[model samples]
Target: MSKQAATLEADPQLHEVFWIMAHEPALGDNLARIRVSKGLTQEDLEERSGVSVSTIRKLEQNDRKSARVSTLRRLAQALDVRTSDLFQPSPEPVSPLDESVHTDLFALRRTLKPVRGLSGIHMPDFDGEVTYESVRTSFLAANALYREDDYRAVVQTIPTLLLEAMTLVAEAGSPDSDRAARTLLSQTFQFSAQALIQLQQYDLAYQAITEGIANAELADDPLLGAWHVFNECWLFLREGRLEDSRRAALTTAETIEPRFSTGNPAEFATWGWLLLWASAAAVRNNQGDQAEDMLALAEAGAHRIQGQELEAPPFWAARGASTFAGFSPELIQIKAVEYAVVQGNTARALEIQDTIHLSGKLSSSTRHRHMLDVASAHASEHNTAESWAILRDLRTRVPHWLRYQSFARRVVDQLIEDRSRALRADQAEIATFLGIES
Candidate 1:
């Protein structure tokens, strides 16, 4: 057998180096292997991925245990394969749970790539009569469910809703009706995309968003286009295209700025929310100065929108959605704190946390998101007690909120791995919640 095939036959867990590379040796090996297979030298990788020759060498030599997921993605794209293909297990047999997760991911990629360049969701035919208002209302309901952290509930609701929206799109006769149908259809697909991402179905999530983007463009709604880009930033971040995500965030925020004005609260909220998204992308990109600058700009916009009579985007009247609301200031701070935690600025994160108003400054989902960031900040500082305390509080208060959130899960995993003690109680709590353990 070939080396990769031999390794796989010997031990399915003999990973090549996947997204989260906790094991250095396997990562280095896979990096070198993929490089050779692509007929690229370290210099070629450095030139193509902009990762630097020394850094590439360090990764291949196992001198560096981890690089940003974005860096890996750049290399993978240059190498011409899915990013997951580079993952190499640590020569250990895969666990049943890991196997199951991978199996599902494999199946998801298979099911979604039904055809080539363009995509559409395969929803069953809607037998009932469909109207724009009804489809819009159901989209709003799905948004409400999403903000409430009921992801699976949203997933269950969307397939039929998608069909109904698609049906409406087909049957609309007038220009106004056509616009309404297309926007609702676009928004519904966006919802489907977000739900799938939350559930960690990345490939499928991407396909859904691709369809959403196409529909958004067809609808020709600036706000829908902004929302589409916002979600695209999230997908790019997850897939480690940090630069593209950052660029999209910055550019798209600017793209929708002209739509905002003092007279229109929806447009105002939409622009400010896009700024917040730009800040989010900057933070993920580790551009501390740029992140701060973006947040400052977003805060200024938020100040303008806060006291005005708040209005949501008519098309996406999802409760507690960042875009539709009249700019939640605390929402921006929550993301900043989350970014700070990731950057290992525990003290700074804590200081920002103090400024966030606990008494409804944010939605329930957002407040909990901030709290999750606090827990992660503590965990990053190796303050096990504080981290677990925040986690436990979340489990008690907003029990379902963190369960499906990928960021929350990643933080929990980091906390468990970084903890000094072997007690692993927090680990057990998260494992139980994830159904990975009793």
Candidate 2:
């Protein structure tokens, strides 16, 4: 307790009330002290533990008296210390789900077993009559839907496209036509994997990706085959198999490197993109050296594009590029920022951040991530006020985005902990939205 918080007891003995208040450590101090010593900014903890920043702050400041056991548990997990240590470790034992509750976004385990032998009614034939041109148009439409991040639309459209492609394969009377049909089928499966991955259905995604790879090889389309490599890398990353992810990405890069000298926009961006994914995967897995090597390799490949987003059909999209600027320098720096943050090099990340021009250079999801990293950097530097300011800006610009992002929630939690009035109302709303008591 601080000097002003003291309370005198009536006719109290020497070992009574006054000494108790004076000697006992505040819960807030313990939480704050340990948090700082461990080099964790509140934002990092929020992302790791899903605890709010406000609760952590208040516990440190003594602005609040009590918190739930769950909050302490989360803080403990993020800090890599025992819950018992937080108390008096100098006040309360830390660690759980007090601040917020989230659906496990990357959980691979299925909840309920599937009902055995359940079958749906057969639907009407897709397009009634199938043709090569019709199937090709549908495939392109599915690709467009994927680009738009409309996973549901892609899911809805693929059945018709897949049915048509299968029809084409069956009717292909010549070896050449048969190969063409298989190639189209491969592309369809690749897209199915992409859509399912985004939807967080990993098992089904695995099946689709496997089938896609098989079809690609038979069709003899190296570009689509390389795409399968990219998809494989992506899947492993999400599965938390960092080494496997890195290997897949590296192997993909090696397999496709022979094609890089062509400067064909399709191959160039795809290669650069795979390398970037490798770098990102390495960063998360503590393979900093590998991440650096991957980014350097990616930068070299990005250079091959020469700042032009070339759309050579069936390789690069005519309407959309993989990234906002088409595998350009801005994209490279943004990825570098991600790596730097993971390395705990906030200063380097910030320096890189300043160099990049973000205007019109990012998609909504990508831009939100960039700002979240910026907020984390400031928080790590112990510049709480400035960090909160950045977070507030993020909230104002993308009000609903934070609610879905674990990082954003951490920043919101911190602002609330600091007792920032500007953040309280928002906090109440977010807490309610997350189904946690404010």
Candidate 3:
């Protein structure tokens, strides 16, 4: 081994630091480097950014891992850089070990991204006969499973569904049958991509969405292609490609923008959904005016839809009904609360949360995300008890889903750090669940 390697091996902490730096730039390190490069002292930064000197010291000393988005935005403004610049790290490549660990999804990976050779593509080997009706039914069942937050079941169901749809496409005899088969196949890919995203398998999710978009185009369905683009924007947001997310969403929304007097409700809902995600991306990127504009446009679309749950093509009744739970005035309100939280207006977030009642209209995942924002808002106000209550309830209700949410982990970490005394039993349990050192 090299001398540097020997030094790192001698100090375990140094080894870990080296590993982290190799994968992603440490946020604390980025903050310190940027501050110094600007010739700003800790006190100077504290005064300019309105961040406390103690907090600045801790961040520079690597005692903290992250700050809230609003805090990052303020610091970035002081530094004259984008908020994303502070969190900059080279893109993390998906590890092959991830596939080995998720062995159950191997078939799915094969189905979504088959091997291509000079001779021809290596298609899934299933020889079973499949009809369009059967494929549609399977797609609906899998979509419902996703909506119910049964991700394990959805993952298990997707590979077979994909194979069956592919079989139908391969064996199709008529143009109408071929179109039907490809349409269902595209929808299946969409559902598969959504499940993969929830499982945090982003690389596979990208493949699935890309395949879906291609199939949609082949089937001559621009609306279906638009839906795929919408989900792609979502994937971009989750990956911290905020500018890509905003641009894609805005461009697609403009392309599909509906006329209030004559547009179909489906058009209105799809347009609204894209705007909502654009708003989300903008707010997280600290573009307050752009965020507000996107939100207003979405709210107008929701108003045009007039509480009607627009049906999705192929089989589902409502557009994004299974995943996003459809775009509605209430859904718009949920997003408003999310924006408020990102802006550090916890009071307004909670106020809006209290007024909006989703009942059973939204999916569990959507509802849970909103609840996370509520918990975050409460925590920011030093209402630890209320925050813990919300988090505990969500953990009890959807433990599997909660485990994958980095946002939930962040909130739990903040709660643990803010407490002066030893963790209570419930606090310790949650901390353990979120993998936070308490």
Candidate 4:
């Protein structure tokens, strides 16, 4: 077993490091072991975790080596173990394998190569390879789920594939392979970041966007850079940094020059989306002139690519808008939030909250955004019970994968205070919901 695995096995507090080092699918092995130790089957994991039977089977075989963190966590819960338990090393045998076959089996296991290339590009120069088969299989599962439009599954698979790809690149160490893997990882980050944003994990998505910006710059890919900027702006907006978000979005929108050619419709669409979102942020910031100008530019840009199809030739061709109602929902959400805050229309804000897609694999930053909205809206209504309820719910979810450093906790704390301010004699329910003594 690797030092990481051993360390994790020995120290539960440091298990997260093991997850980072194990290259994604290691969670599967850990989950399988825990389940079997409990005398459970793949079907049992599926039934308990809400993961598909096929997924459970693949995980058991180590075929789906890159299952999502959330999926693994659920399985861990079902198996009555901490998610950290998945990072522990394989347990040692109580007794050595019977005399004659043990040595041969050990030799065979040691010599057998994993399905992926042992290239140093993917992972560090470690004891063994992370197996290309592992990464590829995981990628396929993710792509399959994406095609099926299963947003939850797609979000879960992205990070796993990214981790697997990183391991492969570290191991291979080929410049060309590294570049290719980086490109793949960049795509994975884009998907994951957006999914995280949708899931209301703003902080985690923000971190992803930061890394994504650096990667895009390294790759010298303008479109990728623009995408990262858009996500970064989205995060800023969610954080109520309206001015900063608008500034970022405006920058992306204005830079659509030589690089925003017909070859990359996605890039152009991103620019247009940024303009639209920026306008909304500007409106929130009370920059009326800026908002109007941006909105006009947004409409023009959207029209420019309305009917065209993306063609990646010597020069990229314009493609029509993405089918996701790309920028409309974001604009609506920002406007609604602004209206709620300004008019103190708590009911309106709460109603609008249902429209934003959130939960499961969302970046921590994005989750914070939704949580803030819930807290703020309820507080505005003087509904201490409701606000405290949301805060308590956040407390439950925060410990699962709250991996980012942001003001999320501060916002929750503020909400708690807001609820407490309005407490009545019989408001022990609110206190209990806030996890505070009555």
Candidate 5:
């Protein structure tokens, strides 16, 4: 099936299965065995399950660690077994859920205890102590790391943590774990939101932020509610929904006042982040006067909370800096390129791009995205030679299914379709980039 059709027809269940297989390395191997025994090729399973072939490959390679639960149930049905059968890891731990829960909890505790002890702080008493709150804390920790651009350290582990939290919540009969699970789910939403944004999947990012808000409400977490609004507004800003973004930010600030204002450092810090984000939106929309006012508010808020640090929240680090500290160099470069395009200044855009260095610290995935952006900006100016050259360089480092591939291809295809003089002038370079005839 075409990629678009496959996405539209994707089975949520199989997606969950792949999610599971991705998390549980042993389970993935087991599933692979089952598939082979059933005489199914990767393509066959992709057709049957509506999971992309690439995901199937990741599972069989034992490269991914967790998947969505909905996917597991579907895979079980496809394999003709109960969901329980999929988690038969050897050297059985107390319970699959507990094992999953404990792994995350231990890692978080290890990271936090030293900080707590050094500060001579007393930890809060657990109310129900069903491991719910502890798991929620773990999600927060992961979020901090994610926000710091430390994607490689936690990306493999977050999916499992989220899946485990979801499972626990689903099985809870009372309202006991509901709040904690919801909090954790909000973190999951944030993680997914950031990932989607990185991929430039704006619609999906909006969906994630919306879900995060729902989870925050369920958890009765006002701070998360504020965060949800802030991020949702951010999505709007990125998509040029400027008015909507401004309204959302203002509404969030109104709701978070006095209470959230005097709360934890993180809470106060979030207020700063929101104001900054909202200000940026205003600037984008040409609300120049409003933009300056909002930016002043953001600066004042950030200044108020400066140097106040906690153990740090998950995903908040990367997000925190970007939000309160102002735009990352990455996003700034993108905007510069965009502005150059708008002013019909292709040469300036290219010049600006040359100075916009890719972070040596960025992950392979992030680096690929940066290069694609550069290529795209060049393509926008009909610099076919330069665009094609950049795309060719990128193709060597990125995979076939990387999201940016579509963007780069769209540019090239449009150029070919136009059949302008530029196309003839750079046909060889274009052909080389497209791997076609000149």
Candidate 6:
């Protein structure tokens, strides 16, 4: 039996603790084992990886459960392993009791990829008549929920939306109706994909995007397909497949490169959005020059769409005049701040943050994400009070959304670790909310 198993057997009270720890990334053990097998000391690995010796020690000793994905990438390159290899795979058939596995996620998974048998794939049953208008309305409502940061409602709404869209496709009578059904179905899948991505369910999100792309193809909508590919790039980034992310974004962006002079707002916005994703992947992968080039291209796209909020083509929903998809000047600035933070230039990050006034031009989700980066920048500069203030404000504004942000948790963890005195009430509250033991 494993040492963990033996230890759990020896002490019942330790069971819960061990169970929780088991779900965390097994980076420490993986690092130690890989380093030993390669016949390298910690110092040797540090020299090769350029990760600090102290950071390596903390990781290997299980004192740290997380590190920047780029740090893991460096170590993986040095060890000749995939970046994913440095973390343990999540246990299969995840426990229903696992806090991360919401019932709605399971519902979504079943709706997206139902079990198949010898006969064929089983389709979900819908009692109500599924009309094109009904599906469209539901899709818009779900998108609104997503924009409002009502994720739980979004998750609960998707299964029915998926079923309705699927039913509409199966029952579509005419050629035009069939195409319309497929278009809406593709969009529904995109919404599902985005929701899953927000919940950090990469594998499920990929499945959703793949299905969406297939539907987009059936509808002969390349722009819609490009949008799906954009989500895939995001999934790649979230999974730490930085090179894959960059390549996918760049390739798709080029395929749909808009003509600035003649292109509609949607085309420019979609293209710009893809370029931003590419830039993000490049920046995170340590290709600063490439990242800048991509960012500049994206900025040009944003300029082309200036003073306009263009809903990217195959519009998912009407989110009002102020909302849009893909690229905006504000989003570009946000990316600049994110890149500055990634480069460890905290001062530059804050300076960029100082210039932007919060405008309705960006969605609440986008604004909250930017705030997290600002908070992280403050934390990195050892400005804990400002960091705490940001966290507190975010928590107040988007409590449910704030809880799921791993970056926020990391920032809070750092604050707790670096504090010279006992945890302040606000710090303790944030830590508890994030499930971090203070």
Give the number of the best model, judged by TM-score: 3
The best candidate by lDDT is 6
Candidate 3 lands at a TM-score of 0.88
Q: Give lDDT tens digits, candidate 6, residues 309-392.
A: 565454463321123453578788988888887766779999998998777767666677778788888987899899999999
Of 1 and 6, the candidate ranking higher by lDDT = 6
Candidate 6 Cα misplacement greater than 4 A, ranges = 1-52, 69-101, 313-323
Segments of candidate 4 deviating more than 4 angstroms: 1-137, 143-159, 171-175, 258-264, 311-438
- The Cα local distance difference test for each model comes to 0.62, 0.59, 0.73, 0.50, 0.52, 0.73
Backbone clashes, each candidate = 10, 17, 1, 40, 23, 0
Segments in model 1 whose C-alpha atoms lie over 4 Å from true places: 1-124, 144-148, 259-263, 315-323, 359-361, 406-427, 434-438
Whose lDDT is higher: candidate 3's or candidate 4's? 3
Displacement of residue 349 (Cα, Å) in model 4 is: 16
Where is model 3 poorest over a 10-residue stretch in terms of lDDT?
Answer: 9-18
The full ranking of all candidates by lDDT, starting with the best, is 6, 3, 1, 2, 5, 4
Residue 262 Cα positional deviation in candidate 1, in Å, after optimal superposition: 4.5
> What is the C-alpha lDDT profile of model 1 across 193-256, one tens digit per residue?
7666555455676787777778878878777777777677665555545566678878877766
Q: Against the true structure, what is each candidate's TM-score?
A: 0.70, 0.63, 0.88, 0.42, 0.45, 0.83
Cα misplacement distance, residue 35 of candidate 4 (Å)? 60
Residue 340 lDDT in candidate 3: 87
What lDDT is reached at residue 135 by model 3?
Answer: 79
- RMSD per model, one decimal: 8.8, 13.9, 6.5, 19.8, 17.6, 6.7
Ranking of models by TM-score: 3, 6, 1, 2, 5, 4
